[model samples]
Target: MDAVEIKGPAAAFGPRHEDINEDANRFGDRYSIRFVGKDKVCTNLKYKDKHSSVSKDVSKEWCDGCPERDGCAYFEPFNQIKNKTRSLTAPHNYLEIFPDILDQWGDIEVVLIDETPWYNIFEKTARIGAHDISHTRSALRKLDDEDKADSDVIKRALSLLDTLSAGLSDKDGGERQADRAYELATSIDFDELTTELTKIHDGRVLEGTDYTDAIVAIADNLTEIKQTARWASDQGIIGEFDSPPEQLWGVDNSTKDNAKFELRWRNVDLMEIARQKPVFVLATEMPTESVEAMFDLPVVTVEDTVTPEAEIIQLNSRMAGITRLRKRNQTFDNLVEFTRSLFGSRLLVR
Candidate 1:
């Protein structure tokens, strides 16, 4: 670990143990497993892959502005919109930032995650329908003019509507929790919505608006109401959507998700690997924030505890910049060999 400092193969905890499975990685003694979190298991034996099984619940609202609104899946229309947009993420962007790292490493590459994407069996599915936040806003403004809203509950709800309206105006997703707050405001109590609407002679909220019915229909189902709030908050989704479906069924054939659950998730019984074990640990090199200065913990300077045959790596103020580390193709064996060459023969197992 000392060589990780002064010389720099800059190491960090990489993927969680759950990231690997029989299909994604090799098993047996060469690998070490570290189990975490809950131990739930599931299987897919009789679930057939059939488009027929997916009966589109006739949610017409999602189709309103979609170019292929006639009959389209959420992902289908989304793919078209997505192609028109681009982002500077990961490998490509980083390569541009540090072009010389490519030259220096000579095609040596350090890997991040495996290529296969895994899906959770219990995936959340948003209902597709037409939604108009502006209409909802109108309904809210109507409530602001009501005489019955003098109560504390009604007052707080109106205040929340104001906050939500301000938040919806902000297009920046990183602006605290404003977007989610706006979504929640859209799904608030029906009485507020009713007040905002132009009521008929019989005191009904306006009926022509696509989302008006759902507001009144789901007023009492608290669980569905919360789910509706979640669906609204998902920025990728638009339209008046209902609560998430009871279940979303999809089969993942990749080795990553369809692997033997027991083998993929097992406890780490040992903290120290045996010297004779032929195993290598993979870690990421992340350039984290540097402390301009620090005091020794407990106000006591701790002396080095390893043998002199071990040479320690030093990380300090001088090596705090982004250039201090770069993703490169490196092996633990190379680190062990380099350490031995410089500080005599000491094993790299810890």
Candidate 2:
């Protein structure tokens, strides 16, 4: 008899084809933003002296789903890491400066390097990827009386969202980050989210967080479900399989050509960003280290504060597009400066 070999148990595969979109920016001007969001690793939670989530209110009027809802009503979760203050990973916090960008460049092409997939996940959850204020805010409008009136929890959550949205409605209000985060949190069908995806999602740690893990769980496992349903329809002929197929778990299949059932929202956002690549990207958080090894362009690090600044690639008929990159050694002084640097020092705000 011949010996037989078998494969390991089925799990999420890898080598995902990331960033299918074309690159808009040329070489030599690309810059990477480090430590952009407010998270535990970025903020030294073990050390109490440098914490920024400090507030006397000690109330949770803000949605518990919000990272900043910890000790006060300030938007964006405050992260303390070894005596460092981290800002919110909320894309809205980063995008609030868009009006200024529009005022300064007046429709200039730009790219925002989103360092983490969480931002993308939030946006896809409700077509509010990158924290597009209007779409995210509108998610609340869809809530029926069951969500608003019957559920006190949802009512409070929505109230906080309304308040934050109003504050950021006109100018970049102080509470916009909080409001934007709320929008992102509410974007997903929390009830449907699966534990696998939620575990990796940064926001899942937040208390009272909504879940959409269940929604994509069955859908991603469509093949397996179909098989089961088909068998049921065919009068139960095949009981050969013991468990649900690997397609069900929509988690950690990072490799390219990895086919698994994915949530519709994530796919939507991914394609949208791919189509509209901006030249200069201002990222709120630092991207994964794998970014350098995987991509064609190098990540250039700049020593600046406030906002993430990159060279604007000029589209000239005669000259080829240019790209510049920096090292990861440089550092920005404060969170405010680094965040502001994304907007750059320029003209009008209108």
Candidate 3:
């Protein structure tokens, strides 16, 4: 033989103990097989040409040309077998031998071939239709909800106006003052004020207009009631006063100084009304503890952990794949198709 070749399981079999004795019994110490018809046998066997096989070896050419190429137990099946397998895989049919291609060539470049430009044009038209439908539906729903809420709010405001009008029916006050009070109370902006005030009161006991002249009136009435009740209690006319009589008027002098003390307390009440303005309770009630705790939580840093070598390699590989895909010549249709593959039908609409 021009070249000594091992076949079947003998290719993997190394020198055995019996081989040493056989070699010793042979004519020469280094024994070799010489087949005279080997050249003729190789010529008779079907083999791939040098250009097709890309190999100088006859065995490699023969293997490449063999009719039972896929039936070989050691290697992957032929392209026909792979194509059949891909047909059964569904959706991602082209990925069957992709890994093998990548292993051989380091990476496989996927070229998106768009033969029909009309598909892209149709897809864009469909996407615009979908977007318009989605937007119109969303807007309609939002407007409907807003209209319902606005109607309810208007009804409640109108009801409040009727109540205010009834409350002032007997009051002998200037119409201008009442008008100003009504304007301030009934204003839509006052809703925010009442909402804030209710938060402070821990409930919705006060209406938007209640904080205006109504609150001042209630406070004045409460002070007068408390004072009268206290006086009656002092002369043994009613229940005993919880606090001292002098504290009510801030008077600590004798009965001779009572009139002066009364005037001073009256002035104090007026001053309290002028200086102590009410604020929204809700705005002031925000939890400081939870906010402070949020600030006190631990922070993450880049130095806490390092990327693994394997992960870095995988990232690099993916980046290379992306770069290769980007460099490939692709039509607009290809991009649309790829995007559709990634996010499904929503990709085009979005």
- Looking at model 2, residue 305 earns an lDDT score of 50
TM-score of each model, paired residue for residue: 0.22, 0.21, 0.12
TM-score of 1: 0.22
Candidate 2 Cα deviation (angstroms), residue 345: 30
136-172 in candidate 3: lDDT tens per residue? 2333234345553254443444343343343234243
- Ten contiguous residues with the weakest lDDT in model 3: 119-128
Off by over 4 Å in 3: 1-167, 171-195, 198-213, 216-224, 229-350
Order of quality (TM-score): 1, 2, 3
**Per-residue alpha-carbon lDDT of model 1 for 1-350, expressed as tens digits?**
11121121211122324433332223222222222211111011121121111222212222344354333332331342234311111211111212332223232222111111111111122221123234434444455566534344444444544443443343442133333333454555546444334242112211222333222222323344344334333422324444332222111122432211000110111111111121122121211110000100111111235788754545488764444432222434545555465332211221
- lDDT of candidate 2 at residue 148, scale 0 to 100: 38
What number of clashing residue pairs does each candidate have, in the order they appear?
10, 57, 1
Each candidate: RMSD to true structure?
21.1, 22.5, 40.8
Candidate number with greatest lDDT: 2
- Comparing 1 and 3 on lDDT, the stronger one: 1
Give the local distance difference test score of model 1: 0.28
Please, what's the RMSD in Å of model 2? 22.5
Ten contiguous residues with the weakest lDDT in model 1: 287-296
Model 2: per-residue lDDT, tens digit, 204-230? Answer: 223333332222232243344444324
Model 2, global lDDT: 0.29
